[model samples]
Target: MFPNLELVKMVADIENPTLFSHDLKSADILFLDLIVSGGNINTLADFIADIPILIITSAISRWQYPEFIKNREHFALQKPISLQMFQSCIEKAIQP
Candidate 1:
């Protein structure tokens, strides 16, 4: 658990367009926990267009995910990742 990291937002529903867009835009990193299929990519891409996304999963690598999402612009962080590693990832991701 990253006690030092401050979570700007965390949303469960992707359908609430107004709130979802607002929350995502305000966050530095997006922690998405879903297996994105072909049909789901377009809408999601729209909302997460400019944000850095971290796909949290128990899988070993991005290869385990669908080809569409794996090849897209995003990072995969295996579950049970350490606090130090998670913090390191956040730091690297937010850098300009």
Candidate 2:
């Protein structure tokens, strides 16, 4: 997919969303798993405003984040997501 892009992985305990607050600032993209952290998604969205977020979850249809839906920087991918689909979402999010 993105041969020119570099990837970084950061692990955070979703149960304690505030634990990794400082670390997320450096991240260009976020791959969030909603199932693990049922915390306030809107707050998280605001925290990372202007950055691209790729949400990964099984309950894709249930998500009702109006801000995320309206923003082109946010993307949702259902569980068991294929590489092609993931690639497509990433491409869409990063597009100018």
lDDT of 1 by residue, 1-96 (tens): 655467787655555456558777766667776644333534576676666555454445665655546656666568777777667777766667
How high is each candidate's TM-score? 0.61, 0.62
Best TM-score among the predictions, by candidate number: 2
Which residue pairs show collisions in model 2? none
Relative to the true structure, candidate 1 reaches a TM of 0.61
Q: Which lDDT tens digits does candidate 2 get at residues 1-96?
A: 588566665554455556666656666777775544445555565556645455544455644544554465456787788898888877787778
Candidate-wise lDDT, in order:
0.62, 0.62
After best superposition, candidate 1 residue 60: deviation in angstroms? 6.8
* Model 2 residue 95 CA deviation in Å: 1.2
TM-score of candidate 2 on Cα atoms, chains taken together = 0.62
**In candidate 1, how many Å is residue 28 off?**
2.5
